[model samples]
Target: MRDSLSLWFIVKNYRIRSVFIKNFFIILSLILLPVTGFSVGIYQLYSKTVTEEISSAHLHSLSRIRDMIDMTIREADNYSIRIASSETLATLMSPSPMHNYDLNVNVLKMSAELNMMDTMRNFVESVYVYSEQNRSVISSQMGRWDLEQFLDQGWLDSYNTNKSQRKAWTVARKAKTFQSESEEKTLITLFRLAPLLETSKLGSVIINIDTARFMNMINQTGSDYIDSVFIIGGDGTILGSNDLTLINRPISDVIPVKDIAEGKPNEPVFVYEDESKQSVSYVHSLYNDWKFVSIAPLKLYEDKAKYIRNYLYISSLFSIVVALIISLVVSWRMYMPIKQIMSVVSRPGEWLEESPPPKRVNEIKYITSSILDSYGEKRELENELRYRLSLLDRAYAIALQSQINPHFLYNTLETINWQAIRLSGGENVVSDMISSLSQLLRFSLEGEDNLVPIRVEIEHCKHYIDIQKIRYPRKVDVQWHLDEKIMNYKIPRITLQPLIENSIYHGIRPMSQEGMITISGQLEGDSIVIRVADNGVGADPDKIERINQELADKNWITANNHIGIRNVNQRIKLTFGDQYGLHMASVPGHGTTVTVRISAIQA
Candidate 1:
């Protein structure tokens, strides 16, 4: 019972069902848009927050490494100044040859003190003193040697190259203090002129630092986030770096010098290399003007936001799936009612599909077409019924006009015709007129059908003309120029008689001389045209205009003077349609012409 009621309700409201699926999708989009936007917004916010946090932490670590490197180099510079000013080193470097015993004691004391100083700092590789006047060298690790025999000649060359400076640090270079050493050691030596108070420079004190040990100290201050580190001199030279091959080279060769120059004193800058991006952070040292730099991969910073990005992807996919399911379920529920209505209204073989169908077979369109077709059929039936009723009314009106004892009038006319023939003792004009009158009355009263053959209508018109000829005597003549093919065509009964009547009474009767009435029939396309013309004094232009206007406007009620012509025009249009009707034309002294047009219907 519930199913039946549901079906009944659905069938009754099937007119509005087409918009259900369209509206469902609209609502689904409204719901899903916000869900998708919110998920994306949350992911972007979280990713931005995480990236900033990681960049801040990495920058702080780089700053700590910079401070550590600066302090170490400051300590090395202070100690190098102390050794250069020592009296024992200055006396040993004098040009005068010292007594062998005193020279040996002074060298022993200086070597012991240098060795102790080298041991104080883990980054310091060795310490030595060179006597330019004696051409001798003293080392903290090795005892003494003549300048030519000493294996570590790189420092002497470096010191000689920049002798004008009171103190300076050389670029990284290889050194060997002993002949038996298999491999050269990489060093950055600090050279200072001896005897700080004297203007005459005799010799120099040197401090050799191991590049590897220096870099190891820098590495200790760093974290895994850093890809590499370097200590760059003010002249753009890489004075210290974890990669030994990069040491002593221009820092601009490995990183763009412009990028570093663009950064503020202590800040991070980003640079892109072919396929990867790196973040470079550095701090400038106030003591030596050297830059402490750290390079880290940018991908590592973005990795911290991966969790939020993954959640966004998952949430977006889930939301899309859920929205699709909800839209489909809702649309299908609404569409089921329309589908049921389609099945009930359509023919037995024409059921709507449950799945999406083609445009022509859509449930709503099919139902709409069915309803429109039914309405058209109903309207057509009503029009036909009204047309028949109108014809019956006209027939009844005609019957009323002839209702003065129609049978008795017919009998009286026949009796008069027979008596006139007997009184004349033969067929005379009076008897002929009586016979024509009887035939006209019987044709009008007895015929019930609205349409008659052209031959029959033409015969009735001749009877009217015969009576008119007897009344006018020798004043009127009639002629028929008709086509043989039009004789079989059907026309409204007594159609041509009224046209002839109008021409005789209104056109020929008013003339002083004998008049001629001519009737002609011809085929024009699908219609048959009949023209009735009379040679007499025609009507005035105004009267002709008024009569034609009445016919055109279907003004049947107001047209009393030309009622016969108007009635004939009305009947032809009602029978064959508006396109078939009568048109009148006249001239002041010439005859009048009435043209009758009707569809060629041959039965």
Candidate 2:
């Protein structure tokens, strides 16, 4: 009888059933919507971050590779210079009593030296010198051959035709060289004409450098993420590469070599594919007019990204299932009680009121109460968490600013040292001055808050300017018009240091004659006014006005003078008030004056 009544009660309870269905759908949507959105957002952000990091890493690797190539080229140039100045080479080319002195002995000696050079340096595959005057060829490896027959008979003729106008030329061609049995031996030769004694002299010296070593150096410096390196010459030839099959191949058969040769130097280009069916490539041209390409598979990082995406999707599905299960449990618990009440009411009015006291399970009662309490607590906790996250964001910004400030100061000091050496100052004096200034500046930068007493700030600025004066003794004139009364007032540390650096770098360094910078500080009514004025090629009024506007609007976020000025201005206003900030005035060809105003803070 009770089971039948319960079934009837359950069928009659439409409100309870509707609530269960509604909550189930609501819970399902809630679980799915945010999870989907969050997963998408996270995936996009991760992808972007990964792409940027990879791009930066690739660029850094390319830069290092370029440096290595430049270094190697410089070494080759040095060798050429040494050889060109040799009396043996001169005598062989001139063939005169003042110079000749037995060509056969000198040839043997030159051959021995070249052999030793090749033995000592793995990169020097062979060394050959061609004398158009004598129509002779001398090589360390092949010995003297008919200059014409060594390469194609027409090769020397072509080289001679272009030798007068072209200072140096590099071409990729097959060369006979010893190789290991296991190694596929395809060689590309780099040939450069040593500077001739006379501009119009027909005789030229050619050095054949090992293309393998050059490619190896580039490959070592390139990012491991890159699959291969290709060295392409201005002429349509693949000079060197890790892939032996491409050696001495025409550029037209491999990639867009003609387009690159005609393109602007150092301009980076992306090639989606090439005829060789290699990976996607990013190409950069060297200063010597050679092309460097870094190639990597397009799908290298794609699988990882896809894996992450799949994991996120699976996690979202799992979360939704869990949410749905919890919703069903809660719905059943709530509806069960309503069903019991309805059953009693349907039985009899008396039973409905009296049986309301039917003992509910303690566990169920506790769960019902906890759910209501948890709903409110969860909302409150979320709000608190968001507030804390906002605070953390601000703290992160402050941390970034703190870290960047010291690094900038340190790099600027290093730049000053280099400039001092360039300006011909004694190394010992410059080192000592830099050491002392570094100690003082480090203290200032690593000290407490941004605010320091005016006296301390002035000392820091003075030490910096003193280092500059040592480098440019009679060239710089610095005038300090500081009022003693304001020395006790607090100001920002290293605030004036950048201004002094700018005065030296952008102002004094450019002028051939004398340059001057004037620094003055005084107290005006409850405010401290500090001015740094430079008498060099000053700022344009339009630029100054634009910077001022940007500072006032607080639009400067990038690292530059305008940004620094804007930041200092904004920080001052934030710490004090809008009235205390920066005011800039300049006249082109006259000078520039930067004035910083801050409320006087007692030491």
- What's the TM-score of each model vs. the native? 0.57, 0.46
Best by lDDT: 1
User: For model 1, how does the per-residue alpha-carbon lDDT over 1-603 read when each residue is reduced to its tens digit?
Assistant: 235435445445643464564656776887688997888787777756655655576688888887777677777777767777788878887777689999999999888768766434687888878888888888888878898988788887778887777456656787775678798877777777775546788778788889888788778768877878888877778888878888788887888846675557555667888767677777777677788777888776556556667777788888888888888687667767565554445532232223233366676666655655575576688897897677667666765665666678889989888888888899888888888899988887776788899999989988988899889889889888999999999999878988888888888888888899999999999999999999878888899899888888643542243238888898888799888899999988998999999999995
Cα lDDT listed for each candidate:
0.77, 0.67
For candidate 1, give the lDDT of residue 28: 84
**Model 2, global lDDT:** 0.67
- For model 2, residues 370-427, the per-residue Cα lDDT tens digits are 4434544765788888975775576557657777766787778778877887788557
| lDDT value, residue 275 of candidate 2 | 29
lDDT assessment of candidate 1: 0.77
Name the TM-score of candidate 1.
Answer: 0.57
User: With candidate 1 superimposed using the best TM-score fit, by how many Å does residue 590's alpha carbon deviate from the native?
Assistant: 39
